[model samples]
Target: MTYFNKNMPSGVFKWRGANKWLLMLLLISSNQLIAKDINLATAINLMLKENPSLKIFELRKRSLDGAQYTAGLNPEIEMGLEAENFLGSNPYTAFDQSELTVSVSSVIELGGKKDARKNFASTKYGLLDAQRKINSLDLISELTDSFIDALATQERIKLAEESVRLSEDIYESVKRKAKAGAISDVEVKRSFASLKQAQLTLKGEQSKLERQSVNLSLYWSEKQPQFSHLSGELFDFGVVKEIGQLHQNLEKSILIQALTMNQRLAESTLAVVQAESKADVNWSLGVRRIEESNDAALTAGFSIPLFKRKRNKGDLMEVEAEIDSSRAEQQIALLELYGQVNEFYSLRQAAIEKFNVLENEIIPALTHALELTKEAYLDGRYGYLEYSAARADLIQSKKSLIDTAQSILNYGVQLERITAEPIYNDTAQTQGGDS
Candidate 1:
């Protein structure tokens, strides 16, 4: 006997089929049951751990550290065995007249060459460290921007979903009025068209959200995002710093520090080159054996180059030129950073003003107008066109608000990148609540 039944409700099967998509929509609509709830600080820490480019830079720094250990050491000692007066005479053929010498030779650095080389290597290592800091800052800024974009896309998706629901409600109302002879069939058809457009907009926003998710995940080298949604507020406005404060912190920026390190590296290199101009002495010590006399003696000698100035003039001049170049580059970098800070600061101020007007005034006014239009349409005092126009205006205004908020975040990230400091600290919530 089999216990099987096929007489289940069609509604149950329909819901079962639709449940997967519904779950996905719910996940996108809210931050619930997420696999990972990453905020700005968490994301940055993850990138620092998993980002491939950052890891490469760290490895390079370690390699430079290893090179520093050998910088101050003398050259390897050369060992040799020499035999003279062998096979030249009958007595030498059997080793009676043979002479053999065993020797070791090494170049002794002069003019503090060892110390200068060590200093140069130390400076180079410091420059690498500075470069790694700059790279990390750049990566963090980029990740912040991408994370904000993903969050904004999520908000847009919610708005699109709202638009779809609104359109559906309006369509149902138009259908009811048409059946009661209060509105024409043409009006019902127009309402249905608006509903379809809203659905299309929702689909488009969902697609955009997926792309933004992929972009954010790319920061940590993940090809696919593990989390279904980002959990952060997009409209977290904070007090903007003054231009003078940003300028004052400019010296502390990783880029400026890197440039300063470069200048020091150039100076250290010049010192090494100047030290190289003094010739190093090569000295040898050995034991010689004279088989004919059957006696052993010790020998020592030293030699130094006579034309040190002519030999090293080119190298010294090249390093001098490099020092001049590094100085000019450092100055240029400072000026460029200042210009960037000012530009982002001005833009941030503008974005804040725009966001305030849209969030505080325009959006609320439009929402009220939309409500009034909806009531008028329900009473048959307004046409489908007017209702749609009002709804469209309100939706556009809301999107504009999101855009302005995104701009604020973008400018904030740029400011952070320039100053190597947070413009808006993420405290797990938006400041003053979500716009």
Candidate 2:
């Protein structure tokens, strides 16, 4: 990057300390009264609390809790009563000749069916938890993307303002030179045109910032944005890991965990279906009364499911196929994850290199060139066209720096989203070990 120059406007340099806060406040317009600045941490907290998509997972967990309860309950008992032979014939029709029976019955599950069902339900909970994490990561990734866009826009607004400022200065100088007859009137017209274009660009960027801010706030359901600005070092991406290092942590992604959980849930379902294949028995014990003998006797009986039934055979095959499908899906997901990691890793490395060259070489050179061009124009050694070209080159270089920095941050976010781990490894952000 160019060395901080004593003669350059303060806006060209990075804002620091109190000047940063002053810049933030000055950026606010008269129309915004209660607006404040927000950081990434605050945006994340608001998104987690107010995001609508996560609420469904909470409701689904409640529904599964009910399913687990239903799965654990035993078969319900039935009560039955029967009377016969009271009204049909002389010997068997009257109440004294009638036989009466009362019974209680229920199905007795076999093959540990209840336990298998309970395990099946319990296994779903683990799967649900994993899916929830995946959804959360997805939402967080989106929020971060919007936050970065808004922050980048904020930085662009500053650059646009700087451009307008320099354009106004050039326009004023050219007008004075035209009045003194040192410069042609055509130069004044050209300078004025450039100044107008710069003003328009500044306005356009400001409008873009408002839209970006609204997008960031909408994640938290705010129709009207509360924060006038998202404050951060958008240029500072910190130390990033190499593509190979990022690949090693591919298993850490929530997507991989979710796939493993799916396979497990499928396997657990197979167990439940296997348990179901073993038929259960229905049984009853009762008291029978013989009116002719005026005596009571106990009776007991049981019936089993058709011994040769094969209805569950189809279900077992289906569950086994599901397990196979889940395994295949895991393989596919790993490949996709690897591909995504590689894409962002390569892109981010290139972006970082681009940013360094712009910051250290190109911008500094253009800044010095623009200063020299302005001096030459004033001394009649160079034309206004040369001065204008230098100013445009410097402005474009600064814009490139901002855009490159934004690209670097976006690539890092994508890598982080893919790995479900921090892609940025700046020492300052790392947590200290427990004492």
Candidate 3:
């Protein structure tokens, strides 16, 4: 391995600190915005900045850096002095009992091993950074999914309410006709049955909306989670980019990026394991003083390993196997992401097509049919069964439209999460004319 000069930019040292700071700044600024309405992106940015999990990862990255700094420092030098007294006097001559001597000692690295340690530490730091990015991306995906679910639940509630309204209209009409003796008691009972079914459906939808609201409140403010205002009107889908083109741009995909970093980290780890097997030499120097003779002595030492049986034959193989495993996993992750994106795109295409047909053709046709059926019933030509069927058909069609719209929004969210890019040009956009 090669070493980079501390003063120069190196291949392994492209400097992640500057870029990390920019990401931090972006998160911080987003969190500081007024808490009016939290969009999906803003909520994620805020969570990244403030979440405890992300903060822990940030601290872990810093600790690894500290380790690198400590490993890169040169071994320290030391000095000492010693003195002692002789208890007995000499017969022929007098000897100095107390004397002091000073000596200096230093440890010198015997090989280019200090640099190797530094390189290994740097590799560990790089791995920590990669892990941090992975965690951040994961958080983003979860937040997006949760937000979309809340919005979809809100739309479903609106459709349920419309169904209830239709049921109420039928119930009132039948009750009036029964009072005039123009309809049988059984017809009035059927209308009451329909109204009860609709009310039950409305109740179920209301409960779902509340549950979804509670789910969103965990990540966002209470006001933001209560998505009661979303109408069954068409939601803005924003600009539609071709799914094929987006799949081709999978290089920017988040899961792929994480796996790629993991592969590099595994390779780096293998290198570290190999480097560890190399022997290290430690040298030391010291001084010693004799109390009775008033004499001084100096000492120096060095150490070297004589065997590497365990490291070379056992631990090294383990590291090699780990690297191979990591490579395989990385490849697998990439394939899975590719397949998932394609599936989501296909579903999105189908949902969009169905939504279009319903909105542009089926819904309008159903509306006209309902009006004509009402007029026919008033003219006393159509039976109760045909009129009731038309009403139910219209209700079912509106429900289908709402469901398809939700599916489209959900697929859009998945696309954004997988790609790590905004699917829509702006957040305020509705799909087609629905928004």
Candidate 4:
């Protein structure tokens, strides 16, 4: 079975013969299965809870949380025992002549390495947190787009169905006129052709809706959609923010914030590398046994690595280079974000203008024209060809209106994705009203 078949309710298909009787029996015994209704809020909540990618980021955040503790920890103590001179010369053969040494040692960090490490880890943790937020924003953006797509598909299906109905009506009228010798068989055939085209369009739209349904289900890692349909208005217009306000709000965007956090993390790592330039001191304390004198004494010493400058210079350079790279990336991201906001804002305005013209002018005119043509055809003043053309025009105009409305909603979603906030908010309305 196809993915669509698996997801679809069984009630959609008819059973044959004995299976039909069984279906009737079952239907009589219980209520029919209905698809669940899903809204935007419910869909987003499900994605947040069940999206696989978001869960991966959540696990990473937890792992980094544990790593933060290890970052600031000191080195572990060490212990050693030696019988160094026992195996040398004649004394090596005698246990009494053996010199034994036992010691404990640990490195004491210098140059504030511990503090630097802690700061670096803290910065890294902050970066991870920002990354999680970025992932969340991305998921939400994707889900929002998919939801809008599903809604558009629903609208398209409605338009297609209406077109099919209009075509069927025209075909029936053409047949009636042909039988009365008022129209030729050629006109009836043209009507039939238009009907077939409308049917194909409806079928295509139905297939698109199924695919869209599956796409929405994928967001929550479901094999099929839980809901039969989405519930929302397609042309529900909301307040749009000013361009300046949207730019200012870009700072709160997860992408931009993550970039800033990355820059800070690089700088913190540089500090850590610099702190490591001063080598830590390895100090040891021990008790030594002198075999000849049969006496014990305490010993203590410290050691440090040489060539610190050359050893750390490469790391310092690498970190410095990364800092510069991060800075450049941040600048690029800012420019790209600005461009995205400007582009979507322009497209949104254009869509709004187009939708207004179609909704207020073109659609109504086409609808009225189609109605007049239908009446004229029924009264023998117009022919089937004229009626079919008018019907097709009306259908196309309605589809165009739907497309424009979807464009406006999609552009709004794109803008919201970049800003990490709703561009259309109550505040926009309040401010605009006051002005």
Model 3 lDDT per residue over 147-209, tens place: 676666666677778778877887787787789888799988898898899889888888876
**How far out, in Å, is residue 399 in model 1?**
0.4
Q: Which candidate's lDDT is highest?
A: 2
The TM-score of candidate 1 is: 0.85
Candidate order by TM-score, highest to lowest?
4, 2, 1, 3
lDDT of each: 0.84, 0.85, 0.69, 0.84
- What total of clashing residue pairs does each candidate reach? 0, 4, 7, 1
The reply for model 1, stretches above 4 Å from the true place, is 1-36, 89-95, 221-223, 424-435
Residue 167 lDDT, candidate 3, scale 0-100: 77
Please tell me which predicted candidate would have the highest TM-score against the true structure: 4
For candidate 4, the TM-score is: 0.88
Per-residue lDDT for 54-140 in model 2, tens only? 888899999999999999999999989999888887776669889999999999999888999999899999988998888888888
Residue pairs whose backbone atoms clash in candidate 2: 1-359, 1-360, 86-93, 87-93
lDDT per residue for candidate 1 within 210-273, as digits (tens), equals 8887888888889998777788888876666567888988888888788888889888988988
The list of candidate 4 runs beyond 4 A from truth reads 1-35, 379-381, 427-435
RMSD of 1: 7.7
Candidate 2 global Cα RMSD:
10.1
Candidate order by lDDT, highest to lowest? Answer: 2, 1, 4, 3
Better of 3 and 4 by TM-score: 4
